[model samples]
Target chain A: MDKPKKSALIQKDGVSISEITNKNSIENLKNKRKSEMDPNELVDSILNKDITALSRAITLIESKNPKHLKAANTILKGCLPHANKSVRIGITGIPGVGKSSFIETFGNHLTKLGKRVAVLAIDPSSSVSRGSILGDKTRMEDLVKNDNAYIRPSASGDSLGGVARKTRETITLCEAAGFNIIIIETVGVGQSETTVHSMVDFFLLLKLAGAGDELQGIKRGIIEMADLIAINKADGDNLKAAKLAKTEFTRALHLYPKKSSNWNPKVTVCSATENTGIDKIWSMVLDYVEITTKNAYFIKKRNEQNKYWLLQTIETQLKFYFFNQPKIKKELKNQLQLIENNKTTPFAAADYLLNL
Target chain B: MDKPKKSALIQKDGVSISEITNKNSIENLKNKRKSEMDPNELVDSILNKDITALSRAITLIESKNPKHLKAANTILKGCLPHANKSVRIGITGIPGVGKSSFIETFGNHLTKLGKRVAVLAIDPSSSVSRGSILGDKTRMEDLVKNDNAYIRPSASGDSLGGVARKTRETITLCEAAGFNIIIIETVGVGQSETTVHSMVDFFLLLKLAGAGDELQGIKRGIIEMADLIAINKADGDNLKAAKLAKTEFTRALHLYPKKSSNWNPKVTVCSATENTGIDKIWSMVLDYVEITTKNAYFIKKRNEQNKYWLLQTIETQLKFYFFNQPKIKKELKNQLQLIENNKTTPFAAADYLLNL
Candidate 1:
């Protein structure tokens, strides 16, 4: 497809082939642009690490324009073989844990290694408010401006459940765009945390060292799930308390069963502000990938997480679709009446309404 | 309605009504039991606080015997007027909170004050593997021996949420039976807690003082919904820790804007084990009821809860029914297959299946 024809096609995104056929004046238009790109050209631009093309490509996939989606998928297919192979890390912590600042420092560290890094953050608070602050891009300005680094703030929409309608697909797009070392940052280790954790290769939990008492510690469930627990903000007056917290956390971690990775969950202290200790953390992660990948466990982990997302997404959709049926819409009211009047138990009412 | 006819109906439980209606012939066979009590007599015995009659009346409702259910409903009708007049308290904590022991001590206190107490405990877990443990009778032996006390475990079934399905209905039965105070005991504040809370005037959250930190104390959402937070096991050395927990909770409570009740939430320290401060807790609850009832909030709340249950039950059944639709069932497999292959997003797949 040539530039001029592509520009014209972009302007009229909805003109399908059937529509084009009806309008013979644009006969050569389909041949000129074709609504699909050469896979080799896509790979060339992506390998050059063109962030603009990557952004536009991701936008195309997200768009409802069927032609644009087809073009985007074609681009992704062409870029597939050349896509960068990098570690996909998932980061999560409770609110007030300075997630953005930490990610900025972490991304900067990765970029310094001559590696291309992509940060995909899904902020829970953003999904609710329609317009998320997109603060991470602003926070990681230096990293974002770096030639090898890409930062895309969460897509603003109503899609919840850590993995959005476009998130997993977006991950694929990011990979095809030749970026390696993908870091998925999610705020809060609650429901949304579960979402990111299922997508990433290694899950890291960050905890604030609040006065170091055993009373102030991460939740047991979240802690147990972590591949590594990093005590964030280990500087100044917090230094002593952070040490105490590290000791307590190490003891508590020992009580949990060994992980499938055969690597015990390690705890470390890091100061994102000071840019200290990030190298050690990176080394630890590298060790995890090396061990797991060699043993064939890394691929198994990805496959399992993929399986979970497939099942979870399907179940959620089924629930949404099931409640919106027309016949059910009518039967529900009659059944509620019967239930209220004691004519039927709720379970039997459910049974009857289901039959209807 | 008479003795011989009722006996014949009872004997041929699953038999046709024709067998029960052969009254003229059956009358001659059981003329001797005419000396036993009639419906009015049984009702009178239950009203006069006869424990055995109350038990039998509840059994009648549980039984499918037409004569017994008819008698039970009639007895319930008489109790309806008296039911709402009692303080319905729902107590729930984690399992192994010594719930039965707590209720026993609490019940004994009420009975000693000449209050007629009725215990309706619903154990959802017990319904499947074991019969429901009507622990009040077994544990509160002193109170059980009282003529004015009634003890019944959940007979409803798997979903304690079916909750005393007849529970609210049976409150009338117990009330008609002359028990002025109703105590509903559940395993804990969880999915079932919301169900029990809907049925009671006051919902109490009992906590093991040192078991959880303030942050870990049931998510803020549940805490905000709580009317009163009582720090149980506040006796002995745990008292200091409990006090700290109370302070932490009090602070956390403030984070939730003042509730619509116009009443500030209060946290109390108590040891249900030593039976200490039981009266104080009751006084606090009575004050809540008095103020809310006098302000006309009580009835409105009950009405809202009933409406909520009706809607929730309807929605749940609607989902179940729609998914089980023959056409929907056949297409779900294909749509899910598309979703698994990434041909369509889960949302899009659901939309297609639902449209079909």
Candidate 2:
């Protein structure tokens, strides 16, 4: 039970174990310093399609440190010009709807078509659950190993606004890193889908066929935001149900007013496990791109989205500043209590807090 | 074309024309002063159910002047304890869905039941169009003439938030005036429906039977918000279509997850013009109330709504304070331009403006 002597763990080259360990620590420090490139160098590396540098820039963007934020902004400024070239697609579905599998199949298809694909996620719940949708790359075994594909898990943050901001900036970094196709994935349970919808050019909603209850459990307004609905798990006996779902969804989609892009949202049946209908989904996305581009809605929508983000950022920051103030924070709780007790109206409570 | 002699024009009573004009002016001034009572007097009159005082209090709440705001807050604080006693219902339909007729018939029915009804509208477009949904009360001729019913035009403001706040405060004033049934009406074409939805105890969506397109042109998420969907104009040849719509909507409603109230949303056909089925609609509302009250979701929802309003008001004010700043006003345009040119990301632009 006695501890082994340090020399007993020495290397075959006859160097002492402690000396080798010290050498390894210095080497690790050197590697860390090398990876912490200056903003200009990081931008240059990203422009050269260096995935390491791209990931580093995103880390900086998501960092809470003021210093990292300054560097992230500098890198963003450098990357901005090259950012909007990619076709950003958003994929969303409720849990167990095969989002990861569909993304894997769709992303691999894109890479096979000579497109560099980058996948990112926005999971606001990850900050609470400490587990993200794409946190395990093994979920997409093939795409994770594809040289032309890069996958990044959802950014952890206290708010969807914060996570969305990081993911949006990460899109720019990925696009600047020569990823021609960016896929933003989110679980279809909350405000994250809307956030993703606002940032992407095309939105795909994945669904699973139920027992004649295809629309149940779907988030409200999500179908309206969809550019396409793909019914997944359409293999074997599920094919009949999937086709039924497609028909139902197609009829339902017609109920919505025509989208601004003038593209009718399509509902199709797909099976990610069998890889059937994956190619058709790609073709539909391209069709959308072509129609929107021909009608000039592609650029118009992007410009509108940019403006939306600008306003949204300002508003979120304004609320954050107001709510985070020590006095306002304390008074807000008191005012809410007063509101609950009917001692004050919400309007009066608001006025008092604003004055304070 | 000769002008009449001034004394001849004015004096059936043997008074000088100038003296009569001055007397009339003084009388009008005295009446105006009488109507513009102090906050305490206004509160007392509102509590006494003086309609004129309630109207004046609402006008004060809708005023933009700081002095009037102070007075309005005082009146609201006085009225807070007496509020929350009414069944606040929100009614929404597209422009041609017979909202006025429906409200008119419904309000008349409520009055027949000895319930004091107060009708208010939230039309954000009124500020721009200079025409409000309820500004012309003639649409509801009978309700306007009903002694127990009070109808107020949509409050005009530059923003929906501002108009909504005014309407919310007016609800307190109305409840204080002993109105037991408060109906907030909004056009379903915009965000006004969502605003109205937040403040109401029950939401009612009015729809028209279409030619096999029951859900077309309906606002997204409107169906999910409804406690009851009343298909109006269900008379003459439209009765069959209305029934069909009710069936379709009932099936569609089933697709939505059950609501927190545990009461299923009902769909029915009603004829506002004939006043048929109005009683059934009211009964459905009462059923909803009974169920929600028993389950305690009625009080819980109201408390959540109050908190929602308080937070909404604070956030709206925060944005107002930020966007109204001279520096931000000038720089926001610059930032938007930069965003358009792809020279800056929204996050970076936001950070720059926030630091300022």
**Model 1 over residues B108-172: C-alpha lDDT tens digits?**
88888889888887666655654565743556666656556777877755455445465666665
Docking class of 1: incorrect
How does model 1 fare in lDDT?
A: 0.68
Can you write out model 1's per-residue Cα lDDT over A1-356, one digit (the tens) per residue? 45554444445667575432354345345434633655446556665666555765666656766667557656655554544266889888766666777888888898888877888876666667755535536676677667677777776555666336566667766786767788888765346677777778899988888633223333445666789888888888887777777887898777666888888889998888988778889999999999998988897776566556655655665556656888877777776665445454444455455555
Runs off by more than 4 Å, candidate 2: A1-41, A65-67, A207-216, A231-280, A287-296, A340-343, B1-39, B65-67, B95-97, B208-216, B231-258, B261-277, B287-296
Residue B219 miss distance in model 1 (angstroms): 6.7
Candidate 2 CAPRI grade: acceptable
- Residue A309 miss distance in model 2 (angstroms): 2.2
Which one wins on DockQ? Answer: 2
What lDDT is reached at residue A258 by model 2? 79
Q: Top model by lDDT, which number?
A: 2
**What would the per-residue lDDT of candidate 2 be over residues A1-356, giving only the tens digit for each residue?**
59866775646775565643575477557558886679999899899988777877888898988878779889999999988998999998887888888988888989999999999998869878868989988899889878899999999887788888889989999999999999999988768889999999999989888743334356647888999999999999999989988988888877777788999999999999899999999999999999999999999999888888888988887887889999998998998899988799888888899998
Q: What TM-score goes with each of the models?
A: 0.70, 0.82
What shift in Å separates residue A341 of candidate 2 from its native position after superposition? 5.1
Interface RMSD values for all candidates: 6.6, 2.4
